[model samples]
Target: MVTDEDKVFKALADASRRQLLDKLRKKNGLTLGELCADHAMSRQAVTKHLVLLEAANLVVTVKQGREKLHYLNPVPINEIYMCWIGQFEQKRLQALHNLKQSLKENDHEQ
Candidate 1:
């Protein structure tokens, strides 16, 4: 079944979309025009990417005055980490801790 994590992963598959996320991360709130300012992609292309990002819940928009301000919603990414990467991270930390203890024991024996 396709879940929200699937949507976020799909949206993040494109390099352009990743770049857009990076821009938003650097500056949390920006208008569409501001996001497209230094980018080489067309405004329409950027708009499409933003739409995908919003659909994936990675980006959120708020209408402020006449402008739609876009902001990065990091919750989805955090969820991805907690559900995916975090599992392996705990094992890796435990292994590192064991290695550190072994090294300390070896030093004491010398």
Candidate 2:
């Protein structure tokens, strides 16, 4: 069982791993070699990143003949957003709106 926090932070920990996720998000179902070509890291490093992503369930791999293609599994990411950002979005927006209204009132008073 993968916890939301574990998946979210682990997936976001490494810049290179984030880049790999971005690439997969844009053009999913890419082979390991295809992903490696886009970055400067060696194949082994990319594989390590992929392992982390996979462990987090942030990525899924499929075998197509001789190649294993990787795809971004967005469910975990969305879960994180809902757990973290969704909880605060309404309050944050209300605070911003209140601040704007206060500023407007102050400007009119001046």
Candidate 3:
């Protein structure tokens, strides 16, 4: 069965989509025209990518007086991090913290 997480991963798998997400991250709310302004992709291509992003729940849209503004929704990404990546990183983070403390102690003693 295809899951919500699956959708997010699939949407993020494309470089274009990821770039679109990056653009949205830099500027939270942008209209289609604004997003398409400096892109190599055509308007139709951008629209298709936006559709995938919306399906993944990674992008959301709001209509404001005729213009549709696209915004990045970070909840799904955070959830994925917390559920998957964060758990694995906990040990590595602790190791890094320990290493930092050791380095600091060694420097102070010397």
Candidate number achieving the greatest lDDT relative to the actual structure: 3
The residue pairs found clashing in candidate 2 are: none
- Candidate 2 at 90: error in angstroms? 6.5
Alpha carbon lDDT at 105, candidate 2: 100
For model 2, how big is the CA root-mean-square deviation? 7.9
lDDT of 1: 0.91
Clashes of each: 0, 0, 0
* Best TM-score among the predictions, by candidate number: 3
Q: Please, what are the lDDT tens digits per residue for candidate 2 over residues 8-107?
A: 6867888999999999988999999899995899999999989989988888999999999999988877876787678658798879999999999999
RMSD of 1: 8.6
Off by over 4 Å in 3: 1-3, 87-110
Writing each residue's lDDT as its tens digit, candidate 1 over 14-97 gives 999999999999998899999999899999999999999999999999999999999998888888778766876888888998
lDDT of each: 0.91, 0.87, 0.92
Ordered by TM-score, highest first, the candidates read 3, 1, 2
What tens digits encode model 3's per-residue C-alpha lDDT throughout 1-110?
32478899999999999999999999989999999999999999999999999999999999999999999999988998798668778899889989999999999999
Q: Which regions of candidate 1 are displaced past 4 Å? A: 1-3, 87-110
Angstrom error of the Cα, residue 22, model 2: value is 0.7
